[model samples]
Target chain A: MINFTILENYFPVINKDIIIGNYTFYIKLYQDKNGYFSLEVDISKKDTKEKHRFVQFLLGLGKDEPNELSCHDSEVPHFKIDYYQREEEAFSATIYFTFRNIAEEELIDYAKGTVVIITKMLRKYFENEDIDIANLSEVVYENSVISELLDYEEKVIDAFYICWKEGDLIVRQKGKDNFVIKTKHNLIKYLNFDYLKPIYLPLKEKIEINEKINSSSQIM
Target chain B: METELDKIQTTITIPLGLKNRIRKLKGSMTYKQYLSKLLRDRNKLAHNESYIEIQNLVRKSAVYSFGYYKVTFTYNEYNNSENFIFDIDIVEIRNKGALESIEKFKKNMLGSEKLQSYQELILTHKLYFELLEKAIQIEIEPLFSHKSRMDDYDAWKKEFESLGLSKKSFDFDVMRKLRTLENQGDAF
Candidate 1:
């Protein structure tokens, strides 16, 4: 096997979240062969109508410098939303969620956390009514996805974050104009999130959720 | 006239290995100086009988349709000189049915507005080999011819300069030629 440790070393630690309507939901990271590092959240049939509404909420988190957001409904049973940044290089995060067994309220509550919100949106899109949540057992990570993430991580370290002053704000409110709004949001902004440093989080805690899923699989 | 020329030029049958060694040794020498030295060496050790001459070297571009090879010579050269020439030929290899499928491919390709020039195609195929041979001849031949003058950097520099070539200029010329060639096909 080709040693992909070099590639895996560069992936930014994505702390993902999902939101359905008003609530945040759970999600799982899946590496796809087409160089997509996807977050999937599985929900139930009742929350199907809120799929577009949930995606709109994600769009509201808005964009940070160097990040572009786009949505596609080109696939059946799932809506694919992609967030990408292209400059001298590119970084992208795609969320695939399928609406399954979970409620819309639970998904909305889950969206309070960044990781949970992203996960809930993905779960609602990727899961089909025919697919059993219990049967989706295999966790496969593509080598290309791992390599791409590693490349993105290196670029993130090398690039200086673009800082914007209040003068650059597009919205000029007459009363609150003086307030210096320096906002960094989205995947690019999350590069600064404190939980990302692998050294701070012990390996045991890092694998906590993954281990739980694995153990639960064994019990089933 | 041919009989008189044959009588004047003595047939020298040197071993292939010896000839190769001499060729390698004469690598840093000028062609004139190398030939002179080789003549002297041949006269001193001229006892061999069997002689083999490489009359010609031809490079052909062959188009295979289905299973048959339809070959046509693209380039040919004949060498009647005493010394053997070692010019490397590099050819591009395609699939067996490439020519037969060309009409279909051309139809698809012509739909695109951009077309490649013939000069560009030829240069892209030939430039590396040309550079390699020229560099080897200029740099290596003189040193082989004169062992005593091995450290003569000035001589090597003069030869290199005399070639009147630069990597940048060569690349530019190739691109320019390619552009001209590409335009020719469209005009016709």
Candidate 2:
């Protein structure tokens, strides 16, 4: 039997929660399973919807910096830290860091140091997510009830979105403030052009309650 | 009359010892043929002829798609480059996304810290050899494959650089972030 000291000693992976700048950062490690085990670190907030998106936006802002990393070493230090960028979902965001390949023996004397350095690097950018979070307020989605935007514009409707399908918001025409609305159940008919305060929490609850009421009456 | 594509001339200098070493292994290949063949097989020597790692700095693309066999290193602007070379089958890691492939290009202009470029060449003494693993695995052809590079290649670069990681800075930020793992180590 092989005596393993660390979790990564057997397999190649490191994942956990890190506390820096008074905020808990959820990070996970993915190592290449093929030749020289390359590693990637993903950082995000926990539980909140912004957890997914919080890191992606922050990384997007720093994509232009000159800190691209890669490792030329082959043994254990065979890893280099590459680039950082955003991984975006429909409503979630995450940021991750890529390293070139690194060997396992590096952990004998260097693994702990490497892990500490990476954490310090993460803390250095604590201000990356320095944007004001808008209170969970009313939101207006003309379609699928999955998204809740913190902010948007009303100058012109550019496109309509559904789960997997989308159409042009409107044809680009000079001096045209009017556009057609397309959807099976569009609130556009019942909505004022200027009043757009409809978010999903209240809307979804209303739908659920109505369905329950209709079912009760039918059973009665 | 020989056509332009038929023959081309270029000068290369090599130590006499290295040349004799290559000649003993060349067998019947002409000097020109040997030089061309040597360039093509330059990557295998890195790890003593087991695998070849192809990393193109220009496109920021990297691939380890060869075994201990006759390999080809074709550098072209378009196309995947080496498709005709037989006796070698390999898989490629598909996460070569660029966070800003041009960061080094910009740094070169801004006159930042000293920049280092990495280059690995492969060379082989023999032409081809059957992989012992192939017979054990009962496989016939090499499959071009891709593995997950990271959570997100581009996103990782952005966060890493935003922390001000230059060779000169030597700040704790670069060290911590680079070495840090999620909730790993004896902590767990």
Candidate 3:
């Protein structure tokens, strides 16, 4: 009973065959069982095991520039695209556009525009060999670390001042403990080992140590 | 010492049908994991009054075997005369298998979609209740007194007949009732 008139009209008119530079893709747009818009992009070439790498690379690009390819109102990009192996021939990929904000009028434009952008990104990825797939995992890990750090605040540990506030880390000089610098960057920015020497301790031990330091400072 | 304990095995002799049912329900999970999950469900059931009533009633009607762990499950044969005895080592209606089956059914019903229609929600609630009822009948009914057993059957029959559902659609009526209550902001 759901309306598919807009979706049906759009896909056929656009012609499933899409040519982006050297790459040719056969894109089929439809609604999946859960009633979400899904775009299945099949690589024209029979040998797509190599081409699946480009799809992963596109996902990596989306993560890097989330603002461009992010879900409706979310800060993080939609990462539901799955590429499954089809026999011994090729790999087929499906990307779901699960945005609640997408309108009927904008459906065609959104799907087409996204496809074009993604295709262009894939083409660029194929041209460049510098972008390693491993770097994508690293970027994802770094973002998660930043998110986890943002949840808690550590005021003073040892002689250094450290606190995470509003996606920025505020830290003071290690040995000098004089100058305070706040930066909106990865933990690596201050993890140089020169400015700050990071120590590994159990949370219970750290809390006990902090309490002891607080009591000593109060007495002094 | 721990490794030696891990090598210990316990024998469980149950009704062939019940064993088959357990095997089907415990898909992709080991027996220990399934039992552990069931124990969690049983602990959760402590907070639910109606489900506790069903469980308690089954326990009260049955006679416990002394010394060795022997429990009875009555499956009425042909003329509702013969009792099917399940010689299980464990305690209380073999709830581990039953609970895991219920959880599996629930997951399958609510697969991916977060939003469900009134009828769909009702159906899901009813199906789970019926599953529990079936489990009770299979694993605990044999030990039930004739009067007690008839009373339970009549109670379920009256409830279903009130909702205008056939015996085959037993689970559906429960679903509609639960769904209606849930939508009206009543605890289901």
Candidate 4:
């Protein structure tokens, strides 16, 4: 079960965070007063080598602007890098994935895409670290789904639980307003494509092919 | 014919001059009733003034003060309840003292035990933090890159001037255009 915090003080800011290895991934879905929605993810870690590796990974995605990087294969818009030193000993580099001016109906899809990208990055980070990246991705996916449900003001949230059935996730709300949400994990990868022509094809396949080609190549 | 229930009878020691002034001001009302009315009016005046101050603060909407943050309390006419928005601008939080004050404010007001009751406050605080987080990403960190770019521009300008190139060859307007392009190329 993934824990999600629905911050009700403001306009429906939902936080679904996870920590893997030394990195902490802070994911948020927010709606502004102007009714525009944004999904922001900040991936931060203190290790210097991790920062270098992360930057290298970002370089693989073409740099659209000075600090903005974009993966043409993914549904996510772009990524920005920032450096923070809250304390002298706690310096960290953070990668911020920002999607602004998104519509409410499209928020869930963007949120899912954000989770997928973060999962992909974590999987790369833990490629040789013996960590179960698949399990982590599943948890992140479930957390994102829960966040989406919470965003719709789904009542009886405490009664809800998610379980894996075959290759899909089954979310059941037990008490009043009972319902079940059965979704394929890959459905999240290719929700809707407004700009891209191929709407039905999962973008993850393209990303995986690119990753495979890059891995096989000797280019640093 | 004023009912006794509508008034409270009381006696207190006071200067004779004050008593004479009170008697003259009391007019058609009892002195005790007038004094109570004065107390109520004074309280109302203070309350109204504070409300006005809060409204003004909200209107100003710039969090520029040092070591202090503002929370404007507003009355919801429809619900007949009080609500507040925690307003803080990350750019204006200039000094370490101001940062310390924010830390203390969050600690005292956003403590876990007190937070359950002020869930709205927590949510509002989180919103401000989100804004600040974005500001840090977009504004604060990019400052270094901007500074280095400016420095490069400055160095280039110095080198060009030191070269003693004919000033009449390049128009001032052309130089200004180039400078703008160089400085603003990568700026958002």
Scored by TM-score, the top model is 4
Chain A TM-score values, per prediction: 0.22, 0.26, 0.27, 0.32
Docking class of 2: incorrect
List-wise, what DockQ does each model earn? 0.01, 0.02, 0.02, 0.01
Candidate 4 per-residue C-alpha lDDT over B1-188 given as tens digits, one digit per residue, 9 for 90 to 100: 56887578556886565577579889989887798897665443221100100111111223333234533211111110011111122323334344434344545556656544344344334434334223222322322112233224454334323322212112111232233233332100
Clashing pairs in 4: A9-B123
Clashing pairs in 3: B74-B142, B122-B175, B126-B175
* A152-177 per-residue lDDT for model 4 (tens digits): 32111110111111112211111323
Q: How far in Å is the alpha carbon of A10 misplaced in model 2?
A: 17
Tell me the tens digit of each residue's lDDT in model 2 across A93-174: 1111121222344232333333333333343334245522221111111121122211221100111112102322221112
Give me the displacement of residue B149 in model 2, in angstroms. 20
| Candidate 1 per-residue C-alpha lDDT over A127-195 given as tens digits, one digit per residue, 9 for 90 to 100 | 522333332221112233333333332221111111121112122122333222234332223323222
Q: Please give the RMSD of candidate 1 to the true structure.
A: 29.0
Worst 10 residues of 3 chain B by lDDT: B49-58
Residue range with the least summed lDDT across 10 consecutive positions in model 2 chain A: A155-164
lDDT of 3 by residue, B84-149 (tens): 111111123223233233234334455666635553555444433443344445443432222233
Model 1 has a DockQ score of 0.01
Give me the runs in candidate 1 sitting further than 4 Å from their true place: A1-220, B1-73, B77-98, B101-188
Better of 1 and 3 by DockQ: 3
lDDT of 3 at B67: 31
Question: Which parts of model 4 are misplaced by more than 4 Å?
Answer: A1-21, A48-104, A128-220, B1-188
Which is the winner by TM-score between candidate 3 and candidate 4? Answer: 4
How accurate locally is residue A41 in candidate 4, as Cα lDDT from 0 to 100? 44
